[model samples]
Target: MRRDEVQVTLLYVFDELESDLGGTVSMREHSQVPESVTTIRDELRDSDFQVEALIAEGNPADMIVGVAADRDVDHIVVGGRQRSPAGKVIFGSVTQSVILDSDVPVTVVSVDAEGEGGDRP
Candidate 1:
């Protein structure tokens, strides 16, 4: 589909416990408005797509699904971390749950590395 025709909604899941505890969390601080949504919107400003952002409390998977269903979004984009074998089993994968539960198509992007470069456009 054309960029302009795409209806994209970015869901940022924040845990209140983490925020309240004052831990060194990435999404809790940097993604208050959901950085992914802002980045995509700014990048695609010239395009015809409509970008919306939602920050919700609770688990990421449920919030993502809820927003997708409510917005009737054509696609849902979520940012995730690439976990190690042990980490995957221990923490599980939120991206997996979101992809499985979402009514619409979901795209998971990994941005774990610092200097790693990829073609965003």
Candidate 2:
């Protein structure tokens, strides 16, 4: 990035399978931010990076791409675990979807599997 350029990390939380049964149930419960997401946001803030956090409920890939488009983001960075092509098909991959589907430039970083991959934000 150039010295004049600024990067704002957009933390988007997506609850894909949520459903409101004929408006009988409230979806406010899904608004809660995960601890891991908060941790990442805190870390980025501490590191002095511009950060914007948003909570949304929808297909993860679609939301990610939508945010990038809506915000006119210059670049997108996503973390992913190493996997074979067959593994990707079977397990499904949000990283793959965003990279292939997005019109903006995308950078993919490998995730560390030391403790848990769930902590990726």
Output the number of the TM-score-best candidate: 2
Clashes of each: 2, 0
**Model 1 TM-score (2 dp):** 0.67
Instruction: Give the per-residue lDDT digits (tens) of candidate 2, residues 1-121.
Output: 6432466766554545534554333344646555656777777777777787787766778888988898889899876778889998887888989989999889876666641245445
* lDDT (Cα, tens digit) per residue for candidate 1, span 64-115: 7887787777777666777798998988787889888887787776665542
Local distance difference test, candidate 2: 0.72
TM-score per model over all chains: 0.67, 0.69
* Candidate 2 segments exceeding 4 Å error: 1-5, 18-32, 113-121
Number of the top-ranking candidate, with lDDT as the measure: 2
